[model samples]
Target: MYTLILVLGICAAALFLAGFARGLRNAVIEYRRGKPEPTEVPDYNYVGMAAISVVISATVIALVGVAPMWIYAGPLMVLGTAAGIGVAFFVERPSA
Candidate 1:
């Protein structure tokens, strides 16, 4: 039961973070599109941010003693990031 809950929680968090990163990236792209000089707006690196989120999230869970680091961290970081990014890519951005 505990393992199931933990897995679900981590999956949910990963999905949310990935979606947020995508949304933020889209917003930045749109913002830059509207600008006369796109170079003026700084670029957003979603991949780096997503990777950081995955690592930090796993670290926090391990530090909190919720589960052993080996149990979920490594596999979830890879799986979660892949799955999350995949899902985010499929989701359609809102019509501007």
Candidate 2:
């Protein structure tokens, strides 16, 4: 019973992740097509970005742990995937 539910949850998460990856790839391709290749390396705070990601992951885990898996897994995964796909579109190229 519990084992079956866990398996289903894992499968659903995998499918959502695959969709997100596909959307991300398409978004990157579209973005590149609209912009020229950069002449200079972009400055980014890699450590800060990683730390923020870790904090968000930890917060999500804590919130999800409070709910029954069956109640939270489906909607949260769907919403998360949708949000990720939507955000991919915001990487706009500057107008000419």
On lDDT, the candidate that comes out on top is 1
> Could you tell me which 10 consecutive residues in candidate 2 have the lowest summed lDDT?
87-96
Quantify all predictions' global Cα lDDT against the true fold: 0.67, 0.62
lDDT of model 1, residue 68 = 63
lDDT of 1 by residue, 5-60 (tens): 57766776777777777778877887877845423545777998899988887776
Model 1 score (lDDT) = 0.67
Give residue 6's error in model 2 in angstroms. Answer: 20
> What is the overall TM-score of model 2 with all chains considered together?
0.41
lDDT per residue for candidate 2 within 1-96, as digits (tens), equals: 557656765766665667666667766776778865567767877998899978876776787768766455545555565555545444444333
